[model samples]
Target chain A: MKITCSKSNLVKGVSIVSKAVPSKTTMPILECILIDATTDIIKLTANDMELGIMTEISGDIIDRGMIAIDAKIFSEIVRKLPDNEVTIETLDNLQTVITCEKAKFDIAGKPGDEFAYLPIIEKEDSIEISQFTLKEVIRQTIFSISDSESNKLMTGELFDISDNILKVVSLDGHRISIRKVPLKKSVADRKLVVPGKTLIEISKILSGEAENVVSISYTKNHIVFEFDNTIVVSRLIEGEYFRIDQMLSSDYETKVRINKKELLSCIDRATLLVKEGDKKPIIINIGDELMELKIKSQIGSMNEEIMITKEGKDLLIGFNPKFLIDALRVIDDEEVTIYLMNAKAPCFIKDDAESYVYLILPVNFNSAA
Target chain B: MKITCSKSNLVKGVSIVSKAVPSKTTMPILECILIDATTDIIKLTANDMELGIMTEISGDIIDRGMIAIDAKIFSEIVRKLPDNEVTIETLDNLQTVITCEKAKFDIAGKPGDEFAYLPIIEKEDSIEISQFTLKEVIRQTIFSISDSESNKLMTGELFDISDNILKVVSLDGHRISIRKVPLKKSVADRKLVVPGKTLIEISKILSGEAENVVSISYTKNHIVFEFDNTIVVSRLIEGEYFRIDQMLSSDYETKVRINKKELLSCIDRATLLVKEGDKKPIIINIGDELMELKIKSQIGSMNEEIMITKEGKDLLIGFNPKFLIDALRVIDDEEVTIYLMNAKAPCFIKDDAESYVYLILPVNFNSAA
Candidate 1:
């Protein structure tokens, strides 16, 4: 295969597919990126069995051919090329020559026939969503996904779509995060669980432009996302997600509206007294027009108070500062309303429009004894 | 101890002493910073067995007392305090209360008597050097210090002073880097091996300003650096340094003058073809007016040619690209002169004034067969 492409275009294409490249595997071929240049446009594909990504590059195709080369070396070479145009040609002995300016690189290549093709899904039931909204939803919920591999279902996020509204939910045992966004058109209702890793990679690829739209198609065991010049296919986890709806409640005995920045900084300051590997929790006491945050550890104790708007009974609760900080950081609103049933019940953070909801289980201070 | 100081000043003092606090040691007191407020100026000190740092902070002394607090927690608390005056008071039970704005912190403290004191060094054998020059010399040679613990002496740099000139040398097994700078006035000749870790910390503390001067004094076993409002004392490495002067020579069969930027970029590009754990060398073929760099590995080969000015016989040699890149990155000159004896001998890089010298041993490529 012979082709001439701009250095920037090739670098972008290679980086997109490199996200799916297997880091280490017994099968050497899995580490290679398949380059198919049989058509007018060159296609680059990488697969790690569970996830596959493909991107296209616009180039001048001299001859129709295909080859697979190491993803890391190709990425680095293309990124460092000085000239604007790069010429790539493949020989019969499975060796590829990359020439740019006065520099030339000959890299060993493998036959493309041994590579596995990405699974094909029929686009009968596809949904369209705004790229900006999808990216925002992923950013809001992905952090709550469980990092432990012991619970496979908790490692994925549940995608629920119905009546033109898309809801993305992620939950570990400690907290639950949900984001609800509206679609332009109504579509068939569907539910699927996608691995958190795949959503993380796809989120990075999206440009987050309000005008750009992404078309998503899914089957029983696989899902595909098509946007810009890239297509990503990932395997779906086969298990029922946690019934988080039962755990979320709007009824609360205490409600307070506080400035997001002020509260976040107060909690951050209180966390300074906490040591690594120490399971100490920061206690929050909500009272009339005021809220106090406190943390006491073996080495030190800190307490800070901030003015707030309260409308219900006073309450005191303890929670891991990191959990609250993570939720607060992603929130863009200036003021956030917190709902608490009691010191023993889980607290909830929700917008007035019910667009986003965050539920965090309180840490029982009695257990410290 | 009772003292009221600006948050910024307290933060800076705490951070400087925190660097010398032991991270993991059986002696718990070594991890604490002693705060003395008996005098008009408050003093903060932290010491590990090998290194110690102390800084004076001017503040209002409410009462005369002293205490030691955990460095990690104290640093964090002072850093996050609001922009206002901070009042720190010690109780009879060794408990400290730090109040700033509306935030208050209660930290557990130990008796100041348990903290180790920094050894006093006599000022008779002292030398003064420009802070800027000393910082520059340390940065230029510190990267070559051995990271291995097997050869303790190689982990330190040789500080040799004579005729009002200070020369610093560092080397691992493959290369040696040296930098020489002149002092303002002459003093007693001294040679000592200072641990690289101590130099690194002191370099961070230096202001690197031409007008600022650093006074250095040494004893039989310890070295002390006094600059600005900080003092750092460290134990000298007890051993004879390598005789690197004999390894440097002016005799050469080939000499070439080339643009430093161009050579560095070329070698960096060639490194892309190399994989981890691969001991491949980049070969430079110096001919009449052209230089060719080539790298061959199991995966592929890459070669590039650049123009150069030759003053001696043509030659070819192989060396690790990283070693060359390290030395070239630190040199401020646009053009550099490289002297080579043969393909088997080490190459020397020196400036016109002989202020800096870098000697790199070539990798034996024949062993790959």
Candidate 2:
């Protein structure tokens, strides 16, 4: 393949596709990015069977052909090239030559036919949503996704859509996060379990552009997200997601409204006393005109009290301090409202507006300690 | 011990002492910092047997006593405390109570008598240098120090003072860096090897002050640096540092002056072709008017050429690109001068003004390739 393109543009395009290339793939071809040159554009594609990314850039094509080159080598070389026009061409014996100003790189290339075929999404089942909203939803829920490889379903975020509202849910059995955003147009109700890896890649490419729209297509086995000349496809987990709404407490004996910054700082201080393997639980004691958070471990014990607007009966609850910090980070409000059912039941935390809800399963502190 | 100090002041003092406390010390007492309260000041000390730090903070002392508390825990608690007056006192049964605003911490404390007694330096020989100048000298040479534990002497920087001039030198077998600064006052000529760990800690503490004076004292077995109200003592590694000056060639066959930024950028690009464990060597081909740098590894091959003002005949040299980058980072000049003795000999790189000098040993690329 022969093409001439701006160094900055090619670098960005190749980087996006390279993210899907596994560092150490059993199949050597999976480590290569397929490059194709047409009359007016150059296309790059990389896949690890589970996830695939394809991006196209406008360039001046001298000859139309295709070649597969090492994704890491190509990406690194392109990233270091000076910000100027760059020329790339395939030479005899399957060698790729990249030239920019006084710098040139000659890399061995493999046959493009050796690469696995990336799944193509049909346009008929595509639904468009604002990239800003999509990125926000992913950020709020992706952190709660389980990283354990044994449970494949929990490692993916569930995207549920009905009417004109889209809801994203993620849980790691210990903590659950749910975020909902209103869509601009009504679409058919659908649910897809997209892997956290794919959601993170999509969020990175979204770039917080409110006007940019992302078109998503999904089938029973695969899901595709298309945005700004780039398309990412991933194999969806074939399993039912946990019913997160049921895991949340239905009734709360106590509720408190506290400044988000003050509560976050207090939890951060309490975390110092929580040992890594010692349950890492912070007990919250709600009393008249006061709220106390305490963490006791072998190393030390810390107690912090903050004035909050509390109501109902006095209650005490213990949960992982990291869970509360994660939930507070995503809640967009000055004040956070925490709903406690009991010491053992799950606690629901959300902003006053209730656009996002986070639930944490309280640990049995007595038994764990 | 009972004392009330400003939160910021206590945080600063605790942070400096905590640097000497090892995270995983074999002796439990070594992991704690000793706090001694006097009538008008509170002293904090932490030691790892080899290195120790002592700093005092002016505070209101309600009582005079001493205690040892976990360094990590105390630092974290002090860091999170609000910017107000903080009261810390020793309770019964070897426990310390820290109170700041509405937060309270009951940290377990060890007996102060169990802590190791750090050796105090009483040498009359001392040198006064500006903190900024000393910090700059340390930065210019410390990166070249060998990190290997096999040769303890090479893991430290050699500080040689003579005739009102102080020189810092460090070498790892492959490269040597030397920085010299003229002191305002004349001090006795002495040479001491200060461990890289001590210099790093000193740099962290010297980051804010621009013109603060640092008083350094050296003995036969240890070196002490006192700045502000803090004193840091580190054990010296007894051995002879390699004669770096003897290894440098006096006459050069060719010399080149190039823009430091351009050369640094080119070396960074050339590093992309060098893989770990590949004996990362980049070949530089210098002509009368041009310079070409090339690297071929398992990943790929890259060639970059830059224009330069050269004198004498053509020459070629092979060296590690990272060493060159490290030296380039320390050079405070727009353009740098490179002196080449031959293809196989070490090359000396320095600025037009002789403030800092870097000598890089050439790699045998013929056998490596």
Q: DockQ of each candidate's interface versus the true one?
A: 0.66, 0.76
**In DockQ terms, which candidate is top?**
2
lDDT of 1 by residue, A1-369 (tens): 999999999999999999899898888888999999877789999999899999999988999888899888888988988757999999989999999876889999999888877888766577888899889999999999999999999999999987888889999999999999887787899889999999999998899998899998898899899999999999999988888878988899999999998888878888887777788998898999889888888777888888999988998899999899989988999999999999889999999888999999999886632
DockQ class, candidate 2: medium
Share of the reference A-B contacts seen in candidate 2: 0.91
> What value does DockQ give for candidate 2?
0.76
Error of 2 at A3 (Å): 1.2
> How much lDDT does each candidate structure score?
0.90, 0.86
TM-scores of the first chain across all predictions?
0.98, 0.96
TM-score of 2: 0.95
Give the residue spans of candidate 1 off by over 4 A.
Answer: A275-277, A367-369, B275-277
lDDT of 2 by residue, B1-369 (tens): 788999999998999898899878789999898987743568899999878999998788898888898887889889988788999988878889999998898888888878886896778688888888888888889999999999998999998887788888999898889888888887888888889988988888774466789988889999888899998898988988777667866588899998898899889988888776667788899998899889887777888888999998898788988989999988889888999988778899975556788999888788655
